[model samples]
Target: MENEVQRPLADFPVNIWEDIFTSFSNSDLGSDKLKEKHITLKETVKESFMASRANPIENIKFIDTLCRLGVSYHFEKDITDKLEKSFDCLDFNQKIRQERCDLYTVGIVFQVFRQFGFKLSADVFNKFKDEDGKFKAHLVADARGMLTLYEAAQWSTPGEDILDEALAFSNAHLEEISSRSSPHLAIRIKNALKHPFHKGISRIETRKFISYYEAEEKCDSTLLEFAKIDFNLLQMLYRHELACVTRWLPEAPNGIPDSMKHLYRTIIDFYDKLEDELEKQGRSGCGFHLKKSLKSTSNGYMQEVNWLKKDYTAKFDEYKENAILSSAYYAIMGVTFVGMGEVAKLDAFEWLSSHPKIRTAAEIICRFTDDITSYDFEHKREHVATGIDCYMKQFCVSKELAVHGLFNIVSNAWKELNQELMRPHSFLFPFLMRILNLSRIIDVVYRYEDAYTHPEFLKEHIVSLLIENIPI
Candidate 1:
């Protein structure tokens, strides 16, 4: 008995045995071509057992062996199941510190069983389901897992019954369990529906309702209410600030305001009242004034720009104490906030584009307008990244479906722009593209480092392209 026990493991040095086992565990071996028919299952099982025996749990290589073997559960089920038992028997956790496999691996294993048409009971799956499970990461990992299983199921022999298992697994997890999760799980469910092997799965139909902003559901009514208040506050802030900057109304024969001093104090008093109102609402003065105010202020600044262009000697701050210089300085601070707000709006738009179904073009424009009105541009990249992560996780395998819903946004924008052309004071194509590019730069920011931190980098690249009529 001792020799029999020792003999199986004794042939291999500990390192070689562990290496062989690790390779088997981690590799999706079924994905590889099975060339040698002579090596039957019995033979393969015998070889695997021999390798495990040689290394043993006490060997230094056990942890690496376990990691690979855990991964191998995807490909070599018989070997893995048997190995699982052996490890359990040895109380391997006591022998060597072993982290329970990653939750990602759990999803992958479940996905593998699913592709083979194995229908695990709901009770079995509940073992792993938790609200806090790295919900976003699982979405991406599971999508990749499903893709692999799909191909394998396709190639397997008809009577092998793997396809049934795959369908059953998909149904249980995706249709049954996934549909019940909160809409926040939309990104993951979307991706899973796109899984190539989803032919027999019926649950794909249920994902339509699960999203951040479904047709029947909106996230927060309070946020919507606050948005309107925020918009009004912003407009007020802009008007008050503009009054402070432009205290000098030209003294004309019939004009009412000749005293700049009196007007300046009135403007300051108006701003203080407006500030109090904004404070009472628990909103930021920066958010209230940044976006709309910045744009309108920019129109004013353009006049200054034109004056400076006509003559370099033009004094940008000619009006002292209460005039041009004060306005320029304060306006610059407001514009900085506007710049950040523009960045955030752009990031949100890119996210909408990536998941078109969730955000219709009309919805995208509406949201853009809201952001512009509110000027909430702080933490632009972080929001985009987090949003993308949500998208990838929610719609992991169903990216096309989510994207399909988004097409109307661009189409609608085009339609609106065309209609506006007939009206006077409409936005021109260049101006539209320039503003859109401000949003487009968010997409570019993630793709290349230059666009994220540097505004001029986008400006130079885009302006050159615009000048040359280059296709973006």
Candidate 2:
């Protein structure tokens, strides 16, 4: 590779995480008594969850709690079966419908269904609007209701004008009520506004929700204790995973530049193993798609580099088209499906290549979220034109409006992502979850700033998830 062009240099911070995971290993967190207690509490929670099925409202709330506590993996099949039944039944669709329920209950059901990819109409919220097409002013007094609607609205798909209105209504009112609410509700609103649970990382959001759930008047002791135990156990596994990953890290070759070798080798080594395994499975053709995605992503990056080198700004449509690959969502998704075993056959890779709405949504999320937040900082350098830049110059708008416009694109992507998850023909739910989880990471990495460049914002989250232990 010969690059005669002089490139821009960035003075990135030193690695704060150098050898930090060395302190973690399975031996340190071992406690037989805690394990036994975890087993007991898990059974207790399971029984309670199963028995709660008698009440429609209570059952949905129970499901929400389990997920929010980050303990749903323990009873994934149980919850899935229940949701499956509910999905199959017309009654379940209407069981917790907004028309028959208050704003809070309706919001809960909407969010839970959307999160799991259940099809529910956004029209149910239409009744809440007054004849004048505005949310009833009186409803603003219902802080809990407002908060729930705000969370529920995050799942809105394209062309859902009412949901768009609902979003604006809830956002404005939540800001208004935050100052006057009780300490607990105020904190919940603040956190939701800063980091929406629907779009937030699973462990990070669950950690915050567990504390809030513990304070609820209806909180069950058994469930609370189980969540705490499950969190600690998972924390150990995360630590162990980190340690294992660090131990086997390949030494980059001296022949390649230091900056390029690390990432280049990591990708090559991972795909090499993946291709080898697929050959064993006699699905070697799957490797072709993997390579295809990898090549496309590299091409996208190269295209961006060329743009910066030539100081050329791409048209808005051109930028978005290239971003599909540049976002690296497709490349990541290729390997994400590898973990599905036989289910990830050759045609599954073909399906991914088709540019499904869900895939496009995830890519948009990755691109726009980073662009909107990091553009100013990046613009200060010899950066390629970001989506924000393309949109701004194309439309000749102020930076603030451009940011807001790009955010609408991000929001629509979320809606499409939510919509795709509910489709009947979608791949095994786990595959879609890979996309969701990856999208969630965008919020974590670029919520207020690009935490990758500014490590300070990310340090606390890394510590919370991997290093700090949840209290027993």
For each candidate, what TM-score against the reference? 0.18, 0.91
lDDT of every predicted structure (CA atoms): 0.33, 0.83
Any residue pairs clashing in model 2, and if so which? none
Which regions of candidate 2 fall more than 4 Å away from where they truly are?
A: 1-5, 52-54, 84-100, 254-270, 281-283, 339-343
List ranges where model 1 is wrong by over 4 Å.
1-411, 424-450, 453-472
RMSD of each: 31.3, 2.9
lDDT tens digits, residues 1-472, model 2?
5866566777777889889897687795758998999999999888888884565766777888888999888998888778777767777667656366878888887888777777678877877889998888888988999998999888887778888898899998798799999888899999899888888899988888888988889888888988888888888888887788787765533355556546766777777878988989977788888988998998899899789878999988999999888988899888888877887889888988887778899999889999988887887768898998889889999888989998888878888888788868467677788888998998779868989788888888888888888786
TM-score of 2: 0.91
Distance from true position, residue 337, model 2, in Å? 2.8
- Top model by TM-score, which number? 2
312: Cα error in model 2, Å: 1.4
